[model samples]
Structures are given as C-alpha cells and as structure tokens.
Target: MTGSNRPAVSSGWGNLLSGANLVRSLALSGGVALHAVNLYISTTILPSVVREIGGFDYYAWNTTLFVIASILGAALSSPLLARAGPRGSYVAAVLGFIAGTLVCAAANTMEIMLAGRFVQGFGGGILLALAYAMVRRVFAEPLWPRALALLSSMWGIATLLGPAVGGVFAELGFWRGAFLFLIPAASLVALASLFVLPPRVEKRTESKPLPIVQLALLTLAVFAASWGGMGANLSSTVVGMVTALGLVGLVIVTERKSRHRLLPAGKFELPTALGSLYMASALLAVTVTCTEIFLPLFLQELHGRSPMEAGYIAAVMSAGWTAAAIYGSGLKGDRRTSAVRAGPVLSLASMATLAAVMPWTGADGDWLPLALICTALVTGGAGVGLAYPHLSAMILHLAPQGEEDKAASSIMTVQLCATAFGAAIAGLAVNLAGASSTPDDMDAANAARWLFVTVAVAPITCLVVMNTVSFKGADHAS
Candidate 1:
C-alpha cells in the first residue's frame, strides 16, 4: 500500500477520544487489546508449558493451529457483523474466547491445550477483523486515521503489560493461572461492549458466504506440514512440506477462480501493485512468525535467561514495530516510498544476523552479543511497522466499489493464513534439524540456526515484490 501522495485529512486524538466516541473507542480498542495481551501471555508461558506437558515436538503446532483457526474466524467476521450487528458480534466473540480460555486453564494434556488455542484464536480473529471493519461505520471519516492509531496502540500496551503478567505468573510457577486471568479481562470487555455498542442493525446482503473450501485447503496445508514434522524420519518431513507447498499452489489457483474469493482481484498477479502488496505483507508476516514462535525458547535455552527476562527481550521486537508504525504513519512522498523499499532489507538483514549469532552457545552471558541480538529483533520489527499501515491503506484505497468492505477485512485473513503456514514451516525446519529427538544443547542451537536461516528467504523474496510495485496512480485516488 503506497501512501506517497494522498492529501492529508485532519484527524486528531482530541476529536477521536472525546464525548460519545470515547465509549465507542473503548469497546473497539479493548477487544483488540484483549486479543493482543492473550497472544503475548501465551508466548511467555509456552516454554513452561512444554516443560510440564511434554509436547516439545508440538511447540509450533500451538501457533499453527491457533493461526489457522484465526483465518476461519477472520473470514467469517463480515457475515457475522452483518447478521449479528456490533453488540451481538462483540458479545459472541467474547463468549467464545471465554470458553476457550477455560479449557486452556484446565487442560492436562498438550492436545487439549491445542484445541483450546484453536477455539481462542477463532474468537480473537473475529474481534480483530470486526474492530477494523467498525472503524468506518462507527467514526467520522476524518477521524479514521486517529481511530486506527488508537487501535494499533493496543499492541504496544500489550507488549508492556502482557509480558509483565505472564512473567510474574511464570516466575511464581503458576503458568496455568495466566490463561485464567484472561477470562476476567474478556468478560469486562464484553460487559463494556454490551453497554456501549449499538443494538443489532437490520441484516443486509452485503456480505457473502465464508470461503470454507479455501479455508479448509489452507488448514490442510498447515496441518500437513506440522504433522509431517512429527514423523520419525526426515523423509516423512520432506514429503509433508512438499505436500503443504503443493496445497498452497492449489489454494492460489482456486482462490483466483472462486466466486467467493479470499483475496481481492489480481492478488495472484505479481507485477501489479495489489498482488505485490499482498505478497510482501504475507511473506513478511511469515518471516516474523519464526521469531515469535521460537525466540523465547532460544533465549531461555541458549542464553540461560530467566522467563521474565526472555519475555521482555522478545517483546523488544514488538515494541520496535509499534513505535515505528506510529512514526511511519506521517511520512510522505519519497520518504514513504523509501521506507517501503527499506523495510524488507531490514527484515532480511535481521533474520540473517540472527542465523549467524544464535548458533553460538557462548553467547549466554555476553552482553555485547545479546545487545546485537536485541538490535536485530528491533530492526526486524521496524521493517514490518514501517510498511504495514501503508500497505493496508493501499488495499482499502484500491478496492472496487462494492467490494470495499471485503477487501478491508481480508487483510487479517491473508496475514493469519501466512502466519499459520510460517509457523508450520518453522516447525518443519526445527524438527528436521533434530529439535524434538534430542535434549543436547548443541542440537537446540543448530535447530535455531536452521530456523532463522530458512526463514530469511521470505524477506529476501519480499524485497523483490516490493521493488516491482508501481505507485504511479495509487496516490491519485486517495
């Protein structure tokens, strides 16, 4: 999404945060924060979970299943909002999340925990997609940018608060309690939403049926990759990954021809801006998932860091992403274009640096190398922060007249699908490199290296896609 030459629309925090808008703002943003906080908390507690539940091999499946379910949830949001309206939709999402968290808190086995995560992801995805969709309906057009900013700020808040809560619980040896804590937070959001959000509006035929077949194919692809990694030998692993890749190809071809398309028109066509934007966004998201799903483990295992310390260190990436997104929102013309081009380079460099540095077991107590790792994490996040909003804005701007809402909501669908695939692929890489079969420290280090090195290709490919985007007429419309 190019933000090169659009005329500025006046929107300020004051206008967005005042009067009736205040309650509306809270309901929408609170849902986003709840989802984000749950994500960070789950990340922090997962290492402890593997230690207790004995599912080290299924580590990435946690994220893969959750993200896959989220794709289904995001895909259904438009129809749900249309039928259920804002208040009904909000309450339903909260209830679903509550049910999932309860299962997570009480689970005694890894399979049960994964099931709970899938349910939670489905609920959270609806909330996320709905929040974005509601921005246009709930706020004055001038205040959209500010409303979006307010929503994004929730992630930064989660980066601070979620880790603190999870770290405290992890340190106290009560990681299960962390999942339970989210129940009350979600309940509070539900109460606030029921009170503040408007009643059910009449249903319209504006939204189409959910693309269930496409979603099923996507899910099968991720499941195949993840299930392959659980095999006893490398041949099975290779077959699984190859099958997943093949299914991905089928999804692309099918999506282009489907009546209910998963992405906007021309998404599979790379030379055009929309296709390139979708590709870059999905690839960058995939690259980042490798870090999110495994970085805490690497820090704790390889660096001998405490749970609290590792959680915060991992959060540095998200903090950098949040800060840079806010900063990049104001860029114009050449600066904006430059940031877009530079983003993939930053991501590529960061992943490559991690590959080289993470394999050194001696990096444990060395502050110099640790600081460099932190720098790489932040730089990797900065790449995403710089380009995401701009890319999203372009998608919304370029959508055909009747398909505008679908296009807006599909952003999350695309990102979530990429995340699901990335997590599975990361699982495959580590499993093949021998993370699951051995407890040797060197084996874990080698797996980390393999994971980072393999994922670097995503960002490298993204750079090529970004370079091909034509921003000529993009600014003219917006």
Candidate 2:
C-alpha cells in the first residue's frame, strides 16, 4: 500500500516499545549495522584497490561526490516518505542501495566506480534519513533519544568489523565480497519491515522543485576541497576548485544575509563554544581518517607487514576507542576535563611516536616498531571517543531552538569534508615521500617521520585555539 493508505501519526513510544517495539528498533539497527559495515569495509579495501587500478588523483572527487549526493539524498527523504509512505520508501532505498553495490562490484573503471559510489551514497543517505524520520514521525518524543543512540551503536559495530571484513577480502582477491554482505542485509531489512517499522502514513505534498542547482553547487564545493591538494594545472582540477569556492561563498552569503538560510541562522554566534567544538570534531576526523588511510599502506610497504597484521592493528585502535567511550561517561568533572584535554595530547603522541620510532625497514633497530605502533593506535582511539561525543553534544546544544536538525547535518558535512581533506593530504604527502628513488630503511623512516610530524601539528594548533578562546559568557542551549 502507498503512503496515502495510512495515518500520519501514531501512539506513544511506550505503546510501540512496550511489546514488539523492541524488535522494531532492532530491525532498524540491523540495517544500520549492515550500512556501517559496508562503509568501513570499503574504506579499508578501496585504498589497495586504487593502487591496483592506479588512480590516486581522483580520490577526493570520489569521496566529495558521495558526500554531496548523500546530502541531497537525505533532503529528498522527507518528501518521499510523505508521498510513497514509510514502507515503500524504505524498501525502495534498500533496493537502490543493493543495485548500487552491484554496480560497484562490476565497475571496470574509475568513472564507473565513482558513479556507483554516487548512487550508493544517494540510496544509503536516504536510508539514514528515513531512520531518523520514522523515529520523529512515529515514536514518542521521549523515546527519541534512546532510539537515536541505538542507531549510533551500529557505527561502533562497524568500527570493529569493517577493517576485518575489508582486509580478509583484499587478501582473497574478493573486492566484490564487501558487497555480498549488503545483499542479504538488504533482504533482512525487507523481512523485518513486516514486523518492526510503523504502519504507513500519507503526508501532504508540495510541487516545489527539487534542489538540484543548490546540490550541484554543493557537489562542486566538495570536489574542490578534494582536488585542492592537487595544483591547478589540470582543467578538471581547476573547475573543481572554482566550484567549491563559489558554493562555499553562496552558503556563507545565504546563511548570514538571506532571510531564508540553509544552516541554522545563529550557528555561528549563539554558541561560539559549540561551533568551535563542532569544527574540532571535523578536524579530528580528518586527522584520524588520514591516519587510517596511510597506516595500512605504510605497514604494507614500509614495514613489510601483511594485510591481516595491518588490520589487526586497526582493530586495536577500535578497541581503544570503544574502551574510552565506555569509560568517558563514567569520569567526574575534572576527570572528564583531563580526558577531553588528553584528546589532542594523545593524538599528538600517536603521530610523534610513529614519526620518531617507526622502522622504515625491518632491520631498523633492536626495538620492535610494531609494539610502539600498537601503543600509538590505542592512545589515538581513546582520545577520539573522549572528544567526539562531547563535541557533538556541545554543537547541538549550541544551535538555536528547533535547529538541531541543521546542527546534526552540519556535523556530518564538516566531518565528510574533513575526512576528504585528510585523505588527500595523506595521499599527497605519501606520494611526495615516495617520489625520490627508493631510500634505505632509515631514509624511509625519515619520510614517514616527516609525514607523522606534519600530522602532529594539527592537534597542537587545536589545543592552542581551545585555550585562547574563553566560553564563560556564552549561553549553551541544546
């Protein structure tokens, strides 16, 4: 049945959650877990695959395209749910996601793969928005927080399994295997729909056109950020750069000057502390994600570690993050402060440790490089979990009343942009490091040393930024 067939609103969360509602949340969770796993698996596997395919220049474009497409996809979900109803809309998204995954598996070139990622991002983005939309429209407001928290937990599961799944397949020549998980996962979502999701509802519709031009502008901004690391010698890169600048200019002008705005109007001023916090999260994400991209390749080529070993280290990082998140909530005010402050320090230590102690070759010295690498990874992960959740909450609190949605969206946008920047920077740095003739073990160590040293600078800058700014006067409202 279509959305026109059901009612608009339903009973309280207590009623829905009392009996079968638990299972319903679980159903959504299952889909989220599958989605998160897909994201991580791809992140880990794609770097190596790109080496095989030989297309480093396009990395930013690929990620940027997906981010912009996803934003549009999320925006579209509101209307689609109103028109097609929840069940139809959700099922359609999953099918589209599945088809996109298939295209990724079959893609024979960079262009094709990028197209697949765009489609996959579009579908998955809608699926994500739909999860939130359902909770908003159907579940009682009181239960909403718990519902969202449960959805977030899936990302934790992804942190653990994504690398493992991606690494195993990379070893087995199964780049396509990553998508296999999605196939059954999609089917399971369909099956659970009969039991878990709320009854359908018909919403009023408007004839306003979809925001394609604005979206295209967003796409251009993303592309520019991704390609900015590369110089303007190439036409495509130049175009990408200009588009990003123009789009950003438009976003700023509209946000401050226009009565109608895309971001929450008061985001820049209402909670200055929160704005800093939000930006900090994005910067941290950039630092960490770049580390993730380079660390694997660095291990494989620099220290001669196997894919499995690199993956295990990645798992170690996740384990540390999980531990920190679990414990971070338990600490007192001062302890929380220490932990929060420790974020930048620990991140800096991680980079400095890698730069100083790294073994360019297995014969570098008597000391074991792997041991130090493990310590760094653990420290880095713990720091991130401590800082990120607080940052997110702070930003949301800082937003104007009823602007939480924009705040949340902005968080994702900043994060996506940061991650893209990190990847590009790492790619450029490593590429340059490798440019000279093959260096000896110590020389290779120097290259990595420089790279890690460069990475360490960001947190130090962040720490300074934090201290110089005082938050004593701002009114923090979440």
Candidate 3:
C-alpha cells in the first residue's frame, strides 16, 4: 500500500460507483450527509429558535453540548459496532438521531433544545465514526482515497441544502419544521443500512472495555474550554482554556499509560508518524472552525448582506474544499506530496488575507473586498481538502496491528474535539474584541480581525507539524 508499491492508476471512480459497492457507498455517504446537513440547518435556524424560545444567553451552549456529546459518541462507536454489528449499530444511531430531532422539534424552551441537541450530536458522532470505520471494512484499499473524498464532499452537499432548508422554514415562521425535516432523511439512511450493510463484521472479536478514565478527562477538557469560551469576561475564558489544556495533557498521559486505549499507540509522540498525522489533522480541522462558525454573521452584519446571501457566500469554502478533495484524490507520488505540502501554505495565506480585509468596511458598490473574501475562503478550504484524504490514508496505513477500528473511529473523535476547541477559541477571541450576539459595525469588524488572526496560528503550526510527517512507506496512490 506504500506509494512505490501501489498502482500508478487506481481502480478508478467506476469501480466504486458501480455495482454492489455503489449501494454501500450511498449508505456511508448518506450517513455523513445526514449529520452534516443537520448541522447547517441547526446553525441557520438557531437565531429564529432563540428569538422564539428566548435563550439568547445560552446560544453557544447548543453547539457546545452537542459537540461534547458527539465526542463521547465517537469514542463509543468501535465498541458499538463490535457489539451491534454494522446494520444494528447504524440503525441504533439513526433511531437516536430521530428521537433527538423530534425532541428539538417539540422543544418549548432553550433548556429542552439544549438537551435535544446533545442527543442529536451523540447520534451524529456515531454516524460519522461508523462511516469512516466501515470504509476499511467494506472497500478495497485502492478505493479508500476516493471513498474518503466522497465522504468529505457531503459537507459541500450540506452547505447547499442546510441554509436553504433552514432559511425557508425560518422565513416562514416554522423553524420547528426544519428539525422535523431531518426525521425522514435519517429514516432513509436507516432503511438503506438494513438492506445494504452486513448484519455483522466477518471477523468480529471480543469488545474491549470502554476507557472510562481517559474519556472523563477528554470530556472535561472539551467542556472546560467550551464553558470558558462562554464566560462573561476574558479572564475567565483564559482560565477555562488553561484548565482545558491541562486536562488535555492529563488525558494524553493517561492514554499513554492505559491498557484500554482511546487512540492508537504512539499517538501522543509527535516524532512518530501516527502522532504527526493526528496533530496535523487536528490543526487543520481547527483552522476550519475559526472562520466557518462566524462567517455568516460577519457577512450579514458588516457587509450588509441578506441571511440567504451570506449563507451561500459562506458555503464557498465548502465548495472549494470539495473540488480540491476530488482533484487531490487522483494524485500520486511527488504530485501528491506537493499537494500535501501546499495545503497549510494556502490556509495560512488565506487566514492572513482575511485578517487584513475582513476588518475593513467597504463602500456600497465595492465588490473587490467581497471578491477577496470569497477567494480567501476557497483557498483555505482547498488547502484542507488537498491534504485531508492523503493524511487519512496514511493514518490507516500506519495504524498499529489489530487496532485499525480504533484508529478509524478516533478520526471523528479528533475532528470533533478540534472543532469544539476551535469554537471555544473563536468565542474567546470575538468576546474579547467586544463582539456580542448583536455587535455594532466596529465591534464586528474588530472581532473578525481578532478571530482570523488568532486562528491563523493553527495553519502555521500545521505547516510545521505536517512537514515532519515522513511519507516514506505511506500510501499516496488514489
């Protein structure tokens, strides 16, 4: 599976797109799409939900609790899959999602909505984890890059559907309907799973006990960061972040020493390939959150755009990512290496560009600034896309013996954790810069500058960390 040993040309898209694999592919991609679209829909309709339910102070908690629950669900996926089998696990996840969506649809208060969101996030996390874990179980090695790319593309699809669905429902004064819409979508995925997925894994083994201690530490770390970011002042936010970091360090140490491992062995040692890959992946994921979570707000408040317009504009980043991922999946050898190396560079430049331009208010007729903003968004997204599939493949390639399922499931865990951290950091940056839920133009501008500038460090650090990842003996072939 190394670069030198792999075929120059893979089985090609046809192999994955046709026959029995096609149904399986749909099942996997559909799971991710369900999760992603729900995310976008929730984000878009949240303003309306708050306006109606009156939990403006706890706006961020919706995402915070959901993501924390998602981390737990992701950690639990491997064991669930082992015990329940593919079909059962997928069905269980879908049922959970449906239940949560129903709860949100019926919620009369912010507290109820937060509870529903937590349940929804847990199911979404399991869906995401199972999709990645099944990639290895169901497909040939040659198709992994393409499969991963396809899964990544679901975000792009969500970017298109989420805003429209949420916007329509919100505009029509029926935001609850938006949550209701997810029920049928999830049911279809469950139906497909019953038909397409195997009843059980072929070589199933005894399930390991859950890593309770490490899970507790990881949960505390994310919760601390999230709670801190929600603090009323900067000092509390800093303390929360510091505490979160300390908790994360403790988790790393505990993971290293524990027999019931959450991540693969050597994951904490940066010099090791697995360690470097995980670090690079986490950093790239962090860069994404810094801009994406707040882009619509900045566009609407500062640039005088409509909600729908801002939503589509924000989606340009996902479009770029999808295009680049599809293109990058076809590369091999030196070209692939070049693409990987270029990812962080592009992201860094994009962040820097945003830091400069996003803070400035433009004239009514000024389209140049808008153009630059779109360009930067695309560049940053493309950077992550180009490198992500290759990095994922490398991790799977380098995973320790008999731990492949854990490695695959942990991909979602790492991503969710990074996203939570990034959101927390972005919250801190914006709050410190005086951007509240309803900020004045100047406050919004300052928040934009501070947020992008602060997040710019992620890509820079990713660039450094990625360089240390030796691709020797790693798979790069599409």
Q: What is residue 219's positional error in candidate 1, in angstroms?
A: 1.6
Candidate 1 vs candidate 3: the lDDT winner is 3
TM-score of each: 0.87, 0.75, 0.95
Tell me the whole-model lDDT of each prediction, alpha carbons only: 0.77, 0.63, 0.86
Candidates sorted by TM-score, descending order? 3, 1, 2
Worst 10 residues of 3 by lDDT: 1-10
Q: Clashing residue pairs in candidate 2, if any?
A: 221-244, 397-477, 397-478
Clashes of each: 1, 3, 0
Q: Look at candidate 2 and tell me the lDDT of residue 147.
A: 51
Model 3 deviation from native, Cα RMSD in Å: 2.5
Q: Residues 1-478, candidate 2, lDDT per residue (tens digit)? A: 2212234434233544456667667666666676567777777778766876656767555666666666666656655665676778778878887888888888777787788888888887777666655654444443443454455446666877887778778878877787776788778886776566645663344434444554555566665666754543347545755666677677666557655444455544423566567566666656566676557656766777787777666666656665666556334355555666777888888878888766435566634677888898888777776666555544544556544444544555556555665555555455455554333332455557667777777678767655633433221221
The candidate scoring highest on lDDT is 3
Residues 441-462 of candidate 1 have per-residue lDDT tens digits of 3377888889898889889999
